[model samples]
Target: MSYVDGYVLPVPKSNIEKYREIATKAGKIWREHGALEYRECVADDVKSGEVTSFPQAVKLKDDETVIFSYIVFESRQHRDEVNAKVMSDPRLNDMMDPKSMPFDGKRMFWGGFSPIVEL
Candidate 1:
């Protein structure tokens, strides 16, 4: 089994390019640090639900779009190790500041998962 970290956030539509630039750099860093896979996806057809949905989950606005991202690791231990290195990496300094992020930090949500099935 593998461990995964997933995230959902709302980014300003105008900042999509900026967000992609940042994610690209981050994915490369994670891969270098041993992440099995790193993926970032933008919403193409997500819609608000009556009770809950990607848009509602991130309090998405008309000028914003949802970003769904994930990083996969060999295991929880590996994830922790990779994340520790990532956090300490000087290349991530600018990205460490919440105020300087491309999206609202308060609105983003993330969690670690234990895969229940692989095939």
Candidate 2:
């Protein structure tokens, strides 16, 4: 099964363009390091849930929107190897710095997953 790294974050509406620019560059870097696929999506119709939801998870604000993204890898080990390289790339230096981020890093979250079923 393919391994995947997924992300959810809250980005201010005013910073969507900036966020997209950053994500595009980051996606390219991840792919160059051997990720199978990289995808990023903004919330269109997602509504806050009573208990839990994308917006709730990110503590989304009225002036912000939710972003959902993911990267596919060959396996867990492959994901790790690719991430190590991506993290060390000098091109991502500013990105590696928390203060330059388009969104609040403290509110962002991500995790690696092992696919259970795929057809």
lDDT of 1 by residue, 19-71 (tens): 99999998999999999999999999898999999999998999999999999
The residue ranges of model 1 lying beyond 4 angstroms of the native Cα positions read none
- What does the lDDT read for residue 80 in candidate 2? 93
**Residue-level lDDT tens digits of model 2 in 2-27:** 99999999999999999999899999
Candidate 2: lDDT of 63?
A: 99
- Candidate 2 displacement at residue 55 in angstroms: 1.2
Task: Determine the C-alpha RMSD for candidate 1 after optimal superposition of all C-alphas.
Answer: 0.7
* Local distance difference test, each candidate: 0.95, 0.94
TM-scores, all models, native as reference: 0.97, 0.97
Give the Cα-based TM-score of candidate 2 against the true structure: 0.97
Report model 1's TM-score to 2 decimal places.
0.97
Task: In angstroms, give how far residue 46 of model 2 lies from its true place.
Answer: 0.7
Best by lDDT: 1
